[model samples]
Target chain A: MSVNVIEAGGLGKRYGGTWALRDCSLAIPAGHVAALVGPNGAGKSTLLNLAAGLAEPSAGGVTVLGGRPAGSRAAADGIAFVAQDTPLYKNLPVADMLHLTRNLNRRFDQAYAQGRLAELGIPLKRKAGKLSGGQQAQLALTLALARRPRLLLLDEPVAMLDPVARHDFMAAVLTAMADDGVSVVLSSHALAELERVADYLVLLSRGRVQVAGEVEDLLASHRMLTGPAADAGRYAERPVVHLQRGEAQAHLLVRATPHDPVPPGWEAHPVGLEELALAYLREPGAGALPGPARGRSTQTSEVTR
Target chain B: MDIDKEIRTEGRPGGGDGETAPAGRTGAGSPVEFRLDAASGVPTYLQLVHQVEHALRLGYLKPGDQLPKVRDVVAALAINPNTVLKAYKELETKGLTAGRPGQGTFIQATLSQVTLPELAGLRRSLLGWLASAEAAGLDEDGMVALFSSALRDFFNRRGGSAGGRGTAGGETEGVA
Candidate 1:
């Protein structure tokens, strides 16, 4: 088995009285892009910060590349983080930004950074602060990618980019992933974008894990059951996540088989991560089918050709 | 059975034993149709979902239309399979597509209720955009003007309006 690039055990954090992340345990395999998703204040940022060693966990612990949050130089060099704000020296020219990063990081890929900027047609002499929102994101991402880090934690990296820039940024990420075996954990409300690139998903809500696993397996396990409200009791044995009961019909998010023998009057269809996420956040302890086996065990080959 | 090999085999054309190729084309048209936009705050899968949904709504696809298999889609689009699956799953949840075992995927004949969850997600994304616009010092009027101007520019760049507003019959024929 491959080593886990990121591993959290009983990870928990609290802000004054409220918990930010609690009992959040997840293992991200080496070289995989895992998307951390949830609603606002869902502890996504906290989890990322802890992973980056920017913030310490209040309860359990986090291990990056088989070491502590403040791991050795090797571990630290293997990881790079792009915060949600896309923080950068606004007055610094794009070329200066690249030069600074190259000086600071031993693994920085200066040529890669310069090439990325050229491909995107971003002016090298322009200051980061003066660049458009989309250009700034591209610059920041270029910096991170140039480092050739083993694990990259991006917190809403594209939240500020324009449509065209967003596409370009994602394309860059895909290219990097293809060329190198870097692992990524991105937390964003942009579920659609996350869905497009993330191989795995970690859903957290109110500081606790709601779901985590391969997207395909998760899709296979969860089904949107549509039928009469009266049939709810019949499916008590199946794993259900959220339920919406109308006057005559009922809709349920159930963990089920693709070919499960449905309860009489109940129709089952697969649920996507977006729907599962929405239902998970909207209603807690609502109608979710009970099960600890949230991770899908589908065999997936390496993406490399 | 080797699933990966099976998938690859299905992706190719002209491999069968001298069967008459269907239609006027030599190979399968590009089934994968999606792109990730860095400038847009909306996520990639959401863009794909909305675009695919829009296409379906505009009658670009019909019942029993086959969508590109998830694997083919990711490889062609250079995206994560999870995202395509997510979008496809969303459509499935909405009853817009049906997963027919061993038959790839097909569009459903009718759609069910537009679930509240779908609407809520859209609202959240729009709200995020609005907040950013607000931070950029764009007021309500500025926001409206920006959208209208952007829309006009987009239309102009595309070589003018569909000639006339809301060409209903044209739209019914999948002109959008």
Candidate 2:
């Protein structure tokens, strides 16, 4: 069996008294592409940071390659983390960046890195800042991929890419994954891309995991139904993720089963991962505090003064 | 069971004489079969492309089997209209599938000449994996076991029905 590459257990993070994330648990299976998605301040980046050992969790912990995230040589060498905006030296050329990364990383695959850069027709001497946003993202992606890491963590890796560039980047990612069998966990706002590429999904809202599972399982567990209000309670116990009521017709998002029978007068339709994520985020009491954390935000603000 | 529901009905804008059927399946007198999973990581268009390619490879989709229209796919899959167009456009670019205005897309006359570039891509991918496998301390037996189990799982997921399967191992034949 392929090894489990990454796991987060009851992961939580707080900034001062404000909890950015709370009680999140998920796993990235070996050789699979998992996408983490949510709204602003939803703790996606925070989770990535925690997993990469760049930040410490306040309530729980994570592991990479069966080791703790912090200072574990095996975990550090086996995983590669690509941060947002992909800050790079403005004066550094593409070759320079690769060389620096190679020097710093023991598992770096120099030939593969060079080959990927060549495939994209990027000039070796071109400065990082001189390249367009799409090109920079590509360069960053190339660097991360060249490490030949067992696990890859990317936060908003494609957010800055244009449509064509984004498509190319995704193709490159898939090609690499297919070639190396590397596991990936990419956090992105590109719902369409996630829909097309993600094998597993972890939806975070207000710093908590609303849902996480394989793509097929997640889709099977949620469905969209349109009908009158009289039968609203018919699917009440189906873990209603989201609901909308109209004058004559009401739209309800129900957590479904693959073999669940269609309710009377209501036809079930597949809901995309993007729609399901939004539904989870929009649910009331979804991000509610566990205990006294609700009033602590103001107190923390006062203390910072 | 309702694979034909999403076939497109629109005739090519500039091409004449709308052919109501998908090209690869026309005049074969054999029923065309396709399976599309909405939850697959591969894009729906690519999935459709590969399905048609697989049919061609298997000879089930002869040169002129009158494939379903794009609208039929949209209706059956409940997918957006543009995605179907994109898939058709991609197929047209590859020359394996064609679209004539007023006429729907069809299999190009030379549909079986799988391109050299495609083969080279497959080779490169396999070589890369082999290298990584070696680096990761996996042996030939491990590789064989992994692939074997994966294929077994695939067959099981496909419900163990190898219907209309040809006796010949056609996977490696007639390729560049």
Candidate 3:
């Protein structure tokens, strides 16, 4: 089994004089729907583009499908990327799109692709441009899966679709993962939706790595401590990722395990993926790089500078 | 957990589109389908584990019945396959289900249950309690809150984790 689908070290990319992503390093394990999340311009798309071999990094290095260089032929053969908006030829018929993709990839499943489209009720002869937004996204995803790659990178794949379409799109992704063992790394602004589907999470902010780890580890290691606002500062010496102050109560998202003693008059509640992610995003200066905690299931993340 | 809301018997979204049919099968087919309540404070895997236990408690699932395939559950629920596998692992750990290599997961045991007569007796008592609570001016939400707190207190009294789902710290403990 491939240990790490994508691994990077001091990975960075510069456009003109500005760095889109800088000093980035993380390991996305072989078997997960890893969520790459952050605000717009947080380098999510930049990182994905670099990993998909669409662009070269100006500094450091990255690899895909085990140790293969990101843009190498071996890596290209085992990876498929559907970028933002999934640019399908607007004028091409759906069947022609599939035909084009099949001819482009070395390992294309034409029959599987055809069967799935028919099941989705997408007419083979309809132009992609004429299809509904959901249908278009589905078409792109179907095309990607038809390649049967070992790893699939999707950038904002569901941001444009409606709730139902988003759900349908994720179901397709899940099916592909389960049946084909394809590892997925998708970036999105939809935290709630990702919570349901993603087992791993990588949070980026202002061109730097902020939080990265298995969703469960991040949730377990941190907690929402609600207490009197006045006493919140007393716990600042601890690893406080973010602190939200209310009129009377203060909620501090801190790095604490279950065995950690809860302070007097404070209630410690388990942090959630959405809650933790948003908190860290709100506190851009906060950095919880992956220390590769001892009990973490697999070290799918790394230290970030 | 609103376990049955928007449940699609078809494993895949397009399962009913002449290629695969999920609702047509009976006894030998998957006895339970999963529903995800993202709004529910429960974790995805725990929601699944709770659903299976719930199915067992209600006699909807039983010994020898097949749990839905991981592929089917993930397809229908649009969740990661690992989450499904984790729930199944939790069930296996609880001695409630077993995976038979080539076959799907099967219910290996049943939750200890209340008999029909006992259930009727309990329902009658609960209805009586509800009538009194109604007399006491408790609204539906109030009644639910009161019942939940009392149930939690009951479990807390036994010194066991509430809901017997101590798998994670995702859930908060209700005060007695």
Candidate 4:
């Protein structure tokens, strides 16, 4: 049986009585490239931070590779995280950075680290602060990869890179994943790029997991149905994620089993990843709070504040 | 290994239509590069499958043609390896291709082509009919609608016996 690389059960993180991520429970299988997508302030970074063991959750728990995060030495050894800014010692030379990584992690692959730098034409004597944005991102990825972690979590790693740099970085990541079988969970706003690389998707909205599952399965399950504007309660068999009304028709995004025949007078069409993600993010109260969270839904209620 | 090297060197320089060096190139193992259109509504894996099927129907690929390695496709497209694997698996399920351990994927079945002797005559007649429709001030969309409706009526009149033939036109004609 394939083990889940990361499992969060009712994971919640709060700051000053405001929950950043609440009741976000999802399981990502090992060796899968999972994409964490949401609008800004959707608590994407908070979830990644919790998974990376950088911050403690205010409520509930999360486990990485069968061990609680940020708790045991074994757990630390199994994970590598590259933050959004690709933080590095600004004054340290590239070679010194490599040395620092080797000294810090026992499993650091020195030859691989140096070889990748040389391959990318990154000079060893140059200071980390002087490198280009793309170069810095590559260096950060190389550091994470050299550690040979079983799971890698990256937050917005490509948000700042150019198109070419993004492509090159993703190529390197894919090659590394193929070579080492490292499972990756990356948060990004680039939907098109994510659709290409990610097999699993986790969509967050208002600090909750709006949708989480395999990409193909998700695409197959949810469909866009257009028909006369009428009550949506008739389709109680399927979960309606979003509903929009037009002058003479209503558009609904519902999750249903593949091959299930569409209801009469309703036109069903397949939904793309971009369209699906946007629908969930745009529609307020589309995914109503689960019964248990009704009393604690104050954070999401203050949308404008 | 030698075959892979030959494909890498010769296939890249040959452009899309180079037919030079026909040895080990005519059968199911002929190398064909796959491409993806991100903007297209069709899923990426379905696009790959359609391209292979199109190549087969066009005789660019034949029984025994070897497909590009999954790693090669992943590196070239910057796509998830699972996507490539899924496309290959879909093709396998359709009995169009099969995987051989360490030997890559090979085309297992040939797509049937329209080899009717009277096809040229039928094409000429259809072109004549299209010209008449144009003369009648029918736009492209109108002509398509009329022709598709007529074709559907023709099939329906045939007692719909051809329903399960896997004909592309028959499947799409019912959508409207």
lDDT of each: 0.68, 0.67, 0.81, 0.76
**Model 1 per-residue lDDT tens digits across residues B105-140:** 666642212344675777799899889999999999
> Among all windows of ten consecutive residues in candidate 3 chain B, which has the lowest summed lDDT?
B167-176
- TM-score of structure candidate 1: 0.63
lDDT of 3 by residue, B1-176 (tens): 22122334444453322322232222236866666656667898998898788777656776778998888888777789999999999998877887989888888676635555676788899999999999999998999999999988898898867446423221132112
Count of residue pairs whose backbone atoms collide, per candidate: 28, 26, 0, 9
**Cα lDDT of model 3 by residue, A57-154, tens digit:** 99999998788999999999989899997799999999999989988888899999999999999999999999999899999999988888999999
- Candidate 4 residue lDDT tens string, A8-77: 9899999998999999887778878999988888899999888888899898888888655644678788
**Candidate scoring better on TM-score of 1 and 4:** 4
- Model 1 per-residue lDDT at B86: 73
How much DockQ does model 1 earn?
A: 0.10
In terms of TM-score, which candidate is strongest?
3
Instruction: Please report the candidate that would top lDDT against the real structure.
Output: 3
Error of 1 at A210 (Å): 1.5
Q: Against the true two-chain complex, what DockQ does each candidate achieve?
A: 0.10, 0.04, 0.42, 0.25
Q: Which of candidates 1 and 2 reaches a greater lDDT? A: 1
Q: Which candidate is the best by DockQ?
A: 3
Tens-digit lDDT track of model 1 for A58-177 = 899888876646445676788889999998999999989988888888888778889889988899998899998888887888899888887888998777776555655665566566
* Candidate 2 lDDT tens digits, A1-305: 34656678888889999989888766666656788888889899998888888888899888877554743777887778889988777799999999999998887889998988897788999999899887888888888888887788889887776654665566566656655667788898877657756867777778887666677566755678888877776666554657887766778886555366667788777777678767776883543321112122222122211
Each prediction's TM-score versus the true structure? 0.63, 0.64, 0.86, 0.78
